[model samples]
Target: MVSRQNIIRVADFIDSTTRSWRTELILNTFSKDDAQKILQIPLTHIPHDGFLV
Candidate 1:
């Protein structure tokens, strides 16, 4: 049930919370971990446009 509005809300939350220096630092640090998880996905499960569900 993930609607477009939910995506917008999540984007807004990310934008608002990452404005501070500390939060930005934490996000930057964890970005690599996020990338690792994303990159570890199987090719068959990846969308043609590269989005994951």
Candidate 2:
């Protein structure tokens, strides 16, 4: 099961993207993964590239 904090973190990450509509569209195009490793990182560790790499 996904944790509440992880959900919030993912949402914030998505919101921080350049365009919400594009972000949502791209996210929807991909299959969901409960083990999104990046989301497991502490917010402080997120890189400037925004984990797009």
- Top TM-score prediction, candidate number: 1
| Cα misplacement distance, residue 18 of candidate 2 (Å) | 3.3
Estimate candidate 2's alpha-carbon lDDT, on a 0 to 1 scale.
0.41
* Candidate 2 local Cα displacement, residue 14, angstroms: 11
lDDT of 1 at 49: 36
Q: What is the TM-score of each candidate against the true structure?
A: 0.27, 0.21
Residues 8-41 of candidate 2 have per-residue lDDT tens digits of: 4444444344323223433444445633443344
Error of 2 at 5 (Å): 34
Q: How many times do residue backbones clash in model 1? A: 0
Q: What is the lDDT of residue 41 in candidate 2?
A: 44
For model 2, how big is the CA root-mean-square deviation?
11.3
Count of backbone clashes for each model?
A: 0, 0
